[model samples]
Target: MGNIQVALMTVLMFFLLVSLHEWGHYYFARRAGILVREFAIGFGPKLFSIKRGETRYTLRLLPIGGFVRMAGEDPEVVEVQPGQTLAVRVKDNAVTRIYLDRLDERSGVMRGEVKALDLERDLFIQLDVDGEIERYAVHPQALIIARGRDTQIAPIDRQFGHKPVGKRALAIFAGPVMNFLLAFVLFGLALLLQGVPSETSSKVFISGVVPDSIAEQAGVEKDDLVKSINGVVIGGNYEKFVEIINSSAGKQISLVVERKGEDVALKMTPDATTGKIGIYPAGEYRKPSAGETLTYAATSMKDWTGRIFEGFRKLIFGEFKLDDLGGPVKTTQVTVEIAKQGLAQLTSWAAVLSLYLGIFNLLPIPALDGSRLLFLGIEAVRGRPIDPNRESMVHLVGFAMLMLLMIVVTYNDIIGLVRN
Candidate 1:
């Protein structure tokens, strides 16, 4: 694949994974009766948007990250001063629309100066018009318009923080859960597309030789059975054959092959750099049964999860060096290399990345889902919620620290790429 194609695919993969992750939070928040204000994919400068029900779905310019903004999660307040003029649209004796801009040509809009308003509890708006004071009930689904942008009003009951602790925790935990599920599905699909490896026996069959490789130059044709290597019986042990080849790099080695029941002799030297003759082994794969596919998929997922956990453990214990860490730039570089290996390999790579993303988000770092769950755990233990301001401040600081870390990691990635 060309660099442009690889770059596009990388962006698409990121978008798919991040969108699903955010959707998990969005879906659960709505299920818990919380008002989700915006379901935004990406950040900085909106490229596209539309209002669907109560939520505004937006696609932004940056494709790096996304978010689901639930009401009452942020410390935002709606204030209407006693002397501020406003236009209101009443329906069924309840104010359904409050416009901050000057009145348009709409006939039903009431122009008045605000007296008092209770948007959270009573949902009523008092206004002074022509020296007369009157109060009108505000609809629960009222639209508040400011500068041509409309947002649905969120009452206390519909707010995220006001929801039950269990529901809130579930909503926060759902994102990582979705990532793992996605990884599982992707792994399953990749396995189905690329046949599962079957068991090999005491005889090795040559499936094919790599183009322009030492094995090809030595006339090692497909279907050639390897009888022995360097006068030592291979006994179909692929590992032993690889061990001999690796130890004999850049050195000529003898190979006895049973081609059509006749012994054929060939000599070849392994690549000096990789120590590989580039001959593919036969009977290495078979079409997997449905049960086998599922089993293999689960096993693969578990193995990858364990490996990623070990990586995290190493990093945490200072066993891993700074160069072992990779940020987005490094990820893109890896994706480009994997993209050249065919779709099956790319799919598997994506599954691994998805698993990593899921696990990374579950770490107990502030400004992440895990941290939110941590706060919820504390709330459950204390029988009272933590102060919202303090929690927000902690997340704010954590987010700043994370951004700084990202900058450093990205800089290192760029430097490494340039050196390579």
Candidate 2:
């Protein structure tokens, strides 16, 4: 793939994965009767946007990450001061819409100076109109229009913090869950496209030998069934054969292969640098039935999840170096290389990436779903929520630290690429 093509595909893949993740939160939040203000894919400036019902779906310029903006999740509040002037649309003596723009000239709109207002609990606005004080009840479904954009007002009941603990936690947890689901589906699809391995025999066949490799120099041909390695009875023990070869790197190894009912003895040395003989193993593959596919997919998910958790454990215990971490640049480089291998490899790589993303989000790190759930757990235990302002500050600080880490990781990736 060309560089431009690789970049575009990488962006598209990220978009699909992130959109699914945020959609999970958006879906559950809506189900919990919380007001979701925006469903944005990517961060930074808006690229495209459209509103449907109560939520504005937006495509942003940067394709790094995305979010589902829920009402009351942000600490910043839109304030209407006592002396501020605004326009309102009334329905049956109740204000159904408030226009903050001064140039709004819609018919039947009442212009007034706000004497007092409360949009959350009281849901009433006392306006000074023509030197007469008037109070109008704000409708529960009132719209707040500003700068040609209309957003529904979120009262206390419609806020995310006010929702039941279970509902709130579900909404927070759904993002990572959806990523796992995507990984499972991707793995299943990849398996369906490329038949699953079905080989289980001690008689390993040499599918192919790399040109100029030690195996080729030693006269190892395709379709040769290895009967023994270095006097060890191979007898279906491919792992033992491999261990012998790896351990005997830069040293000659004897091999006996059965070819056309004849025993052909050969000697070869594994590469000193890589400990590889550059010979491909022959294995049988069979198209999986639906049940087998599901079984294999689930099993693969479980295995990969365990491996990812182990990696996290190593990182947490200081067993991993910072250089071992990969960021977006490394991921893109890997994606480009894998894309050259064929669709099956690319799909499988995507599935693995999805699994990593899912597991990584579930870690109890700040500015992540796991940390949010931690706060909810505390609230549930105490029978009351923590101070919102304090929680928001924690997240803000966490986000800053995360950004710093990303910058360092990205720099390391760039340096690694340059060195390579």
RMSD values, in order shown: 4.8, 5.9
Judge candidate 2 at residue 281 and give its lDDT. Answer: 69
Cα lDDT tens digits, model 2, 272-363, are 97889988765455688999879878998999989988998899899999999998788888888776544666777888888888787877
Model 2: lDDT equals 0.85
Superposition TM-score, candidate 2 onto the true structure: 0.80
- Report, for all candidates in order, the number of backbone clashes: 0, 1
Highest TM-score scorer:
1
Q: Can you give the lDDT of residue 334 in candidate 1?
A: 83
Alpha-carbon deviation at 84 in model 1, angstroms? 2.2
Instruction: Please give me the total number of clashing residue pairs in predicted model 2.
Output: 1
For residue 36, what is the lDDT in candidate 2?
93
lDDT per residue for candidate 1 within 305-367, as digits (tens), equals 899999888998999988778887888878877775556667888889888888888888999
Note the Cα lDDT for every prediction shown: 0.86, 0.85
